[model samples]
Target: MRIGLYPGTFDPVTHGHLDIIRRSCALVDRLVIGVAINRSKGPMFSLEERVAMLEPICAQMSQDTGCQVIVHPFENLLIQCAADVGASIIVRGLRAVADFEYEYQMVGMNRALDDSIETVFLMAEARHQAIASKLVKEIARLGGDVSKFVTPEIEAKLKDKLASS
Candidate 1:
């Protein structure tokens, strides 16, 4: 089976992330959503919360897409995580030139680390090209409407989390 790894902080999964997930599912036999432990970025949700939020959504997506989706948490090296999960390919979404530059460098590094691992880049759909989780959180924190960017469940959770903080 062609196993692909889609790794991200997913502080809160946005439509953009889901778009990539949807596209990646069609390309690989099995897709694993690797949630990174990135405390340095100061995510809006805890690691546990992020994983919890993704589980049900991934499960439903797997049912809908017929692509087995698994959410797993990882720390430190991403290349190691991919190896651990037996992922032969790393799937990434590119939104713009900035994304391309960054991801291009990472792809090179990942190749150096694991010669057998290949990287695939999927361009974000036009509607979601500008939607990023960081920006979504920022907009939501300032009371801006993010209903269009994230799911209702995530929107509610983001609003509540921001309101309490």
Candidate 2:
């Protein structure tokens, strides 16, 4: 019954995100990929599109890793989602000191909000340390190929989105 929450905007679920999802799969019985509605950033895709993108990715992850991965969109404080799911852990992927600095503070805040919940930090694979959704969107917007960053499915969605936008 050990469940964990992985909350993020997931603007476009990249391989970097998948890497963390893959690694965390081994340690928990279930992992909820929380597609948070982040009002702070302009999203390239809509919430529905993001959820659509995550559905297949999560299904594939479960099939490949034998770990149950489900995607949920939460508009409230992240701790509420964790509480609703009865998850006592928050899984975060740390890529560098800069990443750690922000995540550390957020982790502390989440812990303070819910003392029963603990945040688990997972280091991103060395190669993916610099790859982020912002970077991917920037590359695509500037007509640079980002095939290696996101899945083929995500790439197509991005292409279609960019083409129309």
Candidate 3:
């Protein structure tokens, strides 16, 4: 089976992330959405909380697309995580040329590490091109409405998190 790996910090999965997930699902038999344990940037949500938040959303996506979407957590290198899950392709979303340049370097490094695995870059839809998790969190921290940038569920969670913080 063609398993694709979509790894991200997913501090809070935004609509742009979901867009890539949906599109990636169409290209693979199964898509593993790996939530990286990134403590350096200090994520708003815990790894478990992030997985909990993604569980239902991935289930819904799986049901909607007739493909399996597995949410997994990884603390190791992305290539190692992909190998652990038997992923032949790594799906990444590019929002702009800047994203491409960054991803290109990473893709080359990943290829050098494991030539068996290939990276696929998907362009973010125009509407979601500007929707990044960091910016979304910043906007929410500043009391800005992010309903247009995320699902209602995610928007509610962001609001709840901001309110308590």
Candidate 4:
């Protein structure tokens, strides 16, 4: 089986992400959506909460797409996580020129870590190209409607976090 790893901060998975996940599923036998740990941006939800939020969304997609999906809160090195999971390829969603610049370097670094590992970049569907988890959270935090950008569960989680703060 061709295992593919899709790693991201996922503070809360957005529709744009789901879109890529949906498409990527068709290209690979199995896709592992790794919730990568990043201390710099500081996630809105705890790691546990982050994993929980991914469950339903992932399940729904897997059921509909016939793709096996796993969501894991990966706390160590991204390349290590992929290797541990036996993923031969890393699936990434590229939205714009800005994203390309960042991912280009990341792909190179990942290749250095494991030359056998390859990175596949998929362009976001047009409507979702501008949507990002940070952008969704920012709008949701400011009381802007993000119902369109994220799943219902993520929306509720974001709303709850914003309310508590």
What's the TM-score of every candidate structure? 0.98, 0.97, 0.98, 0.96
Candidate 3 backbone overlaps, count: 0
The digit string of per-residue lDDT tens for model 4 on 29-121 reads 889999987877798888888888888888888899899988977888889999989999899999999999999999888888889999999
Tell me the whole-model lDDT of each prediction, alpha carbons only: 0.93, 0.91, 0.93, 0.89
Error of 4 at 147 (Å): 1.1
Over 65-124, each residue of candidate 3 has an lDDT whose tens digit, in order, gives 988999999999999999999999999999999999999999999999999999999999
The TM-score, computed over Cα atoms with residue i paired to residue i, of candidate 2 is 0.97
lDDT by residue (53-164, candidate 2, tens digit) is: 9998899899998889999999998999999887888999998899999998898888888889989999999988888999999999999999989988899888999999
lDDT of 1: 0.93
Which is superior by lDDT, 2 or 4? 2
- List ranges where model 3 is wrong by over 4 Å: none
lDDT, model 3:
0.93
Report residue 42 deviation for candidate 4 (angstroms).
0.7
* Prediction 1 TM-score vs. true: 0.98
Stretches of candidate 4 exceeding 4 Å from the true structure: none
Q: C-alpha displacement of 112 in model 4, angstroms?
A: 1.5
Q: Is candidate 2 or candidate 4 better by TM-score?
A: 2
